[model samples]
Target: MNTAINSRIPVALTIAGSDSGGGAGIQADLRTFAFHCVHGTSAITCVTAQNTLGVRRVDAMPMEAVVAQIQAVVEDIGVQAAKTGMLLNQEIIFAVAQQVEALQINNLVVDPVMVSRTGAQLIDDDAVKTLCHTLIPKAVIITPNRYEAQILSGLQINSLEDMQAAAEIIHKTLRTKAVLVKGGGMQGDLRGVDIWFDGDKLEVLTTKQVETKNTHGTGCTLSAAIAANLAKGKDLWQAVQQAKEYVTTALTYALDIGEGQGPVGHFFPLWGLGTGDWELGKKQGSREQGAG
Candidate 1:
């Protein structure tokens, strides 16, 4: 890599876990960042043995290890924006929050991966608490699914109005700069809707709902895309808007590879056009010409 060219490229960091399934977590975040033309870096918080069926086991990295990775990346490469996902436990969450403050990471996107879209709590109560009190406040914006919004805002999200209220409550109570209440876990017409609040203005964002079960990395991809856009110098509102659009388009091309739920195509544009496919197609064409 040319040092001068590499230095000029926009860089984004993801402090998250590694999904061996290659669907979500660090994998999804890095792919999303690359799709947006941002150089992606990561500090893995945990490792998971999982597939599309579900996670079988999880092993969290020590708090010190997580911090060391963050320091290594931030001190040298210097990310323009960063995002956090699946910090596993309270220790790691607290440690990451400290690093964020110590490193002065201003353009931070928090994906609050405490609760799943299906209403299952992934992290323990203490971990969630730490994320709320320690990490979230330092974020430029937080992307919370419906269940996470309910946990953070102390409200039930049954309708669009409830999502709006939850976004506002999270912004005010959590002291974050902005809140995005994701509606992917919602039912019926509200499923793909989202509410945004920035302590100044509120907006209800709606996009064409792409019907697909392969939505494994939707949340991770969305947050990563936002960070990527931020790394590219877009403002908060623009970043969120573009990220949502990118996710929606990616969902339309969601990969259906696994036995269960698959992941959104982070590089949808390159679908069926990988180097291997290109070579194979070229060889086949040459064979057909010889036959002719």
Candidate 2:
């Protein structure tokens, strides 16, 4: 809203699908980054006919075009951090992964978005191989909701124990830096716990559940917010914490827009009293843990 004052916001890149409903995918990433005063760059992998409730259809961009978008930005203005979501096909996945490597980008956040909340699968089963092999290994953080973690690691996740087990399986098998196995899918009375497994130790973050149906784009927002904090120089643990806190606050202040699940007000800090700068909790002379 105040473009003049925020002209030179720090840059973050998001490679994902286009959400026509503006509740998820590229739109949510951009809004989340802008909320943190980070300039957002996007490489739209596909276009989806989607709303708060569900996805009606999805049309993917060609591999050539997807590669071109990443090249067009990363090679030009450059980026401090990047996040990926909803890479529909294998071609686009390979292209984006190669570009991230070729561009030598760091602090990359990967949200393995396979299906929509409404049960429409966005990614092909074949693409899963390419995504796990090509992209997962290079990412600084991987945010996989319960279903996604199960899919990636081939582990049955029914509890926090299962989430922790799956996180290790993913990390050891893929060799990615850190994995955040989101506990949003955990069963039973103890649910709001999200597990972030660094290489050596596991960090458990829990919050009270906000009983709202307006939780669309939560995964995308969390991963993008982590990338934004990484761009702002927070290490992996701090960034993850910052992202979790932001998501909780956003969910608490949800606008309840749209007929189905609504979008979080990523601009909460701008319009309301948002939790601010948790990475300010960082101690002096801190460092990241081996690229996570």
Candidate 3:
């Protein structure tokens, strides 16, 4: 590795859960940050035993410990931007929000991790209020998948119009500054689209969805990648565009890593490119980088 290009490592923080299987959560966030050449730090709020199949169990981290981690990072190394995932309870949500407000952090991307792709409940039922009232206002941008967006906004989204309507409402009501509604669950033949509502403008972003099982951690990776780009000073839309490109490439090279579903080849870029390592698909998966 050449040290010449390694100037100041732009710092980004992820306040999310831990996935022992490494498909999603902090593990995936770290890999995505490294791919974009940003230094990553984390404040883990829950621990889980999971794989490509689904999350089997979750134990929320103690609020005190979570507080300690956030304090340590913001007070020491100082993050350029931050994002969050899977907050299990009300107390934890409030805990994270307080610290974020105190620090007045910028470029905060919130990935409301409510449910798993396998339909497992990752967030607690009782904490929805706390999440909206506290976390939403603190975030610079909120990235929610179709279901998660629906739940967070209390809107039934089945069409593009509905998604745009709900995104604007959520943005205004929550005062989140911006709401990015991801249409990965769009009906019938339409390419999956993600909409971003930044108070003034509504941008709908689309990418052809590949029919593959390697989509684990995509939401987390997208938000983290956006935060990483923002850490490097890209504006909101530019960050989202770059993040979308990264996910597209990652998904194009899906990894058959687990017994049940599978994870996207996080390091899939290095194989076809030759000089670098498709660190995940090559070192960790049977699939090749450009195989998709």
Candidate 4:
């Protein structure tokens, strides 16, 4: 109960599912927060049995349990910012929305996890409706990947122009403060290009694409970094810009573990005294194998 020390450290909350894979969801969120020096709190909406390969099973928490976790964190530790991912159902979505309003949680970032980067819809129609109507509008910003942007804006995204259009449509319809239409699922020149649209300004944000299959947690890491920056008192634009940079650097040091796609190195700065020589080692190993 030392208010002095607690007051100095910024606190952020991630109301997301638990990924047993340790690659995405709450796991990624917490790791990103720690890398930013923010205190990370979590209210797990569900538990997933998964790994780098794929998710095997998912079990959602009860609505009441989710609500209680939010209340516990907000009332005691105090959250400066928050983000949500994988609400899983209408009940959890409705509950989270109500809690966001009731707790007056600001600096909220919503990663609309209704669709996968590969264009598969994860949530049902009812849950999607509830999220768009009740939860999304409460967010300061919503980060939606390519397919999710298409679903929210009812437009196809094939080019930068299409991404800009989708961002505009999503901003106009969802009424969120801003919309980030992600292009991670895109191809060729369009990949790694994100479109940002606030009510007054529309900007194209781009970063160098790291060519690797280990992009499993990029979305979660990006949104969580945004929340962490917000908690540290950065404005929305600065938070977003810095977060994108962080994610790109993380991708550069993407971990090459597991049988399938791995995760970006959330602790890249701490990797072997900041040398990040593991990446060099990986490249050397590959070249040696080819030569043999």
The number of the candidate with the highest lDDT is 4
lDDT of each: 0.89, 0.81, 0.81, 0.90
Mind giving the per-residue lDDT tens digits that candidate 1 earns over 1-292? Answer: 1112246789899999999999999999999999988999999999999999999999999999999999888887788999999999999999999999888887999999999888889999989889999999999999999999999999988999999999999999999999999999999999999999999999999998777788899999999999999999999999999999999877876767779998876876674564576444334333522211
Question: Where does candidate 4 have its weakest 10-residue lDDT segment?
Answer: 283-292
1-292, model 2: which lDDT tens digit per residue?
0112234566899999999988789999999998887889999999999887677998989889988898888776778899999998888888888888888888899998875533355578889889989999999989988888888789887777888898888888988999998876666654558887877988778876766667788999999999999988889999999889898877765656778878876765555235443332121102211111
Ranking by TM-score: 4, 1, 3, 2
Give candidate 4 misplaced runs (Cα > 4 Å).
1-5, 274-292
C-alpha RMSD of candidate 4: 3.4
Give the number of colliding residue pairs in candidate 2: 0
The sequence of per-residue lDDT tens digits that candidate 4 reaches over residues 1-292 is 1112356899999999999989999999999999999999999999999999999999999999999999988888888899999899999999999999988899999999999888789999999999999999999999999999999999988999999999999999999999999889999988999999998899999887677788889999999999999999999999999999999888877777889988887887775566767666556434532211
TM for candidate 4 is 0.93
TM-score of each: 0.92, 0.87, 0.89, 0.93
lDDT at residue 280 of model 1 (Cα atoms): 49
Error of 3 at 55 (Å): 1.8
* Preferred candidate (TM-score higher): 1 or 3: 1
Q: Model 4 lDDT vs. the true structure?
A: 0.90
lDDT of 1: 0.89
